[model samples]
Target chain A: MRKSIAIDMDNVIVDIETNWINWYEKEFGVKIEREELLGKPEDEAFPDPAAALSLIYKTGFFRHAPIIEGAQEALLKLQEHYDIFIVSAAMEFPNSLPEKYDWLNEHFPFISWKNIVFCGDKRIIDTDYLIDDHLKNLDFCKGTPILFTASHNVNVTKHKRVNNWNEALALLGLH
Target chain B: MRKSIAIDMDNVIVDIETNWINWYEKEFGVKIEREELLGKPEDEAFPDPAAALSLIYKTGFFRHAPIIEGAQEALLKLQEHYDIFIVSAAMEFPNSLPEKYDWLNEHFPFISWKNIVFCGDKRIIDTDYLIDDHLKNLDFCKGTPILFTASHNVNVTKHKRVNNWNEALALLGLH
Candidate 1:
């Protein structure tokens, strides 16, 4: 049997930061630089933290998040070597589950519905490798935790890190 | 720390059989006896197997499933002694995710969103006890597999069985 890998959806596969930054600029009419927001959590990055954070709770947030660059190609390659599961901490946003499903269906068509997992907590997932952006999710993982880089998680350095899809591919020996 | 328990949604906490039976009767304009469904898979028990199976994939099927008798009370009591997680294999029906969430919210309000897991497979779930209706799910579980009785699973006697919520409570020593 092939080894299994549990991948986080939000920052790992879907680039929520870019969409959020764009949404924040459009909503508040204030252009924010990606560099200026580096190392800051989504809420703390903006002038109005509450308003910026509220975007995630909105209905279409996950649906509109752009696919991370090189993710589709890397995942397709990884699929042949390992069992891939898209695990998202989405139960917190009850309305986002369907949107996340539709988002995965539309963007990552190669990923089967059987490989998707939407839950409130990530502690229950048992796999060989867990590639996630959030430390909270990875901290509890029994598998090898690979930290996927995001602006908010830039300061986190204890785990093995992957700055991009290419790095993740190379790190996993897929390259 | 309290031992964790993973509970199935359909045929366990939610009485999907009664709703499905009622749906079949209303759709086909025929009175069907619940006794006739004993030891038979839902699809095989009805006149139109395909039609009966189609009811599950239809929208609102899971959303409207009636709560099992004594499930809420029993679950609440169990919650004090065990860490309860409602794990459902729902990814096959992508659109049903939000509906299932809403259904849990409506009926099992005590089950926090943090404890719900909607996934395609149960193999990845790590818990101390898995109380599920399907043998396929239980067979893969690493924990104590407690089979929750359903019409389709009536013949299966491979695991610890609980015919209803009351029996389940007693079996778990909550009664």
Candidate 2:
């Protein structure tokens, strides 16, 4: 049987961190320094984290997020060997449902709608491997968890970490 | 921590079996006998199971599905004691996404949009209790699995069974 792989959307597939930073700078007139954000919560790293974070949850935000470097090529290659599923914690923002759907349809049209999951909690996902940036999502995975490095999750080291799509593809033996 | 409950939407909460049967009759001009369907796959019981099943995947089918008797009341009452999430394997039918969302908004408006999950595989769901009609869904659950009795699952005996919403309520100590 082909091993099932569940890939997260935010920092793993799409560069939401860059989008957040750019949106914050454009909206709040404050360019947050990366060093200050290291090892700090979003609310602590910025003047108004809630407002800044809320911008991404609005309609059309996910549709506009730039794909992570090498993600498209790596995912296309990975799709040949594994049953890839895009598992996103999208219920927190109801507006994200259609937007995420459209985004996936545009970028990863090869991924069937049956492989896309819009969920609230990651604990319920059962797969052979999970590639995600958040420890909270990886902590309870029944399968092997590979941490995709992100700015906020830089200090988390409980699981095997992959810094980029090349590393992730190699870790999964896709390369 | 509050115990979390994951509820299946199809036959458990909404009467999809009945709707399918009714639709099959209307579309094919052939009335299917309930006995012919017992313990058999839909394909075995129908002239064209693919076509019959495909009707339910259309955009409007889910929006018009009748709620399982007492489901709305039981879920509402159960909501007072536990954190409830609707975990539906809806990604199999892409058109069902917006329809299911709209149906929940109209009927079970009390369920926050945050609590609704649309996914393909059920194995990824993690919760304290899963009330579902399929043994396939319950077989891999980490939590207590309460088999919500449906005609197709009537012969399944591996798990504790509840014939109706009242029985489900009683089993969960809500009665």
Candidate 3:
């Protein structure tokens, strides 16, 4: 049986840190060092985090978000060995649904629509492995949790961590 | 607190029974009366159920599927009193994701994208009420199950059956 892998989209496959930081800096007119966000929840990393995060809920943010370095290549390689599902807590931003779908279609065309899951809660997902950037999602996963490194999650140490796509591929034995 | 109602998409909202019957006749060149399909799972209703059902997996079938009579009106009215979520087993048909999303956008624009759940298994859903045509979905639901009468499920007597949208509205005291 092919092992199934449920991958989170925002910080895992897509590079939200770079885009968010740039957007936040330009929008807020405040310089935010990347390290300032380390080990902090996104809301706590900045003043008025709700307003800052709401920018992501806008129409074009997710559609134009940059793909993390090596994510496309690693995911394509991973698809050959496992059932790769792009699971995201997209309901938080209702507009992200079509944007995320279009983003995946553009960047990860090889992934079938069946493998894409847009849901609110991660606890409901049952898979062989879950790769997520948030501890909240990983904490409830029924499968082995591989923490994908993100600025907000760097301090989390409960699960095995993958700093980059190469590390993820190696950990999954895809390397 | 507004009660959450998770509504199934296929027969409960979109009229798949009529569309499937029409498509089955054109593709298979065999007339299948609606009554003949009663009480039978979709696949078992035909000689080559796999092939018959595969037609539904095609691109246009779901996008072009007609809405169940009164579903739109009923849902609009229900939205006034309850939190409505459109939950469908869309992952089973890979091609239906975008189609279903677009269909909802066109027909049920009042429903926010946050309420749309495209998932494989319905067991994970947490809601107050589940309105679905499939007994398999309702059997595992954590809430009151309202069986929406579909041709395949007309014989089902296990749950509170609502034969039409008017009946459904009346049962929920929305009428």
| Best by the TM-score measure | 1
DockQ of 3: 0.25
How would you order the candidates by TM-score, starting with the best? 1, 2, 3
Candidate 3 local lDDT, B1-175, one digit each (tens): 8897899999999998888888888887887788888888877977788978788767699998899999999999999999888988886775677788889989999988767888766765667899999988899897899999988887787999999999999999988
Worst 10 residues of 2 chain B by lDDT: B38-47
* TM-score against truth, every candidate: 0.97, 0.74, 0.65
lDDT of 2 at B16: 83
lDDT of model number 2:
0.84
**Model 1 CA deviation exceeding 4 Å by range:** none
Residue range A24-118, candidate 2, lDDT tens digits: 88877889766767766555666787888778666667888888999999989998888899999887776777788888888899898778889
Q: Where is model 2 more than 4 Å wrong at Cα?
A: A25-37, A43-47, B1-5, B16-65, B76-85, B105-115, B126-130, B134-162, B170-175
Error of 1 at B80 (Å): 0.4
Q: Write the per-residue lDDT of candidate 1 for residues B1-175, one digit (tens) a residue.
A: 9999999998999998899888988878877788888999766988788988888887888889899998899899999999999999999877678888899999888988889999988899999999999988999997999999998889997999999989998988877
Q: For each model in turn, which proportion of the native inter-chain contacts is also found?
A: 0.97, 0.67, 0.33
Could you give the CAPRI-style class of model 2?
acceptable
Candidate 3 regions with alpha-carbon error over 4 angstroms: B1-7, B13-86, B90-116, B120-149, B152-175
Clash pairs, candidate 2, are A124-B124, A124-B125, A124-B126, A125-B124, A126-B124
Residue B75 in candidate 2, Cα distance off native in Å: 3.5
Candidate 3 lDDT over A52-170, as tens digits, reads 78778666888888999999999999998998888888867656667887898899998877577787667656678999998888998978999999998887879999999999999
Error of 2 at B128 (Å): 7.0
* RMSD of each candidate relative to the true structure: 1.3, 4.4, 6.7
Model 2, span B42-160: residue lDDT tens: 44556687888778766678888888999999999999998899999887766777788888888899998768889877776778999988877899787899998777777887899
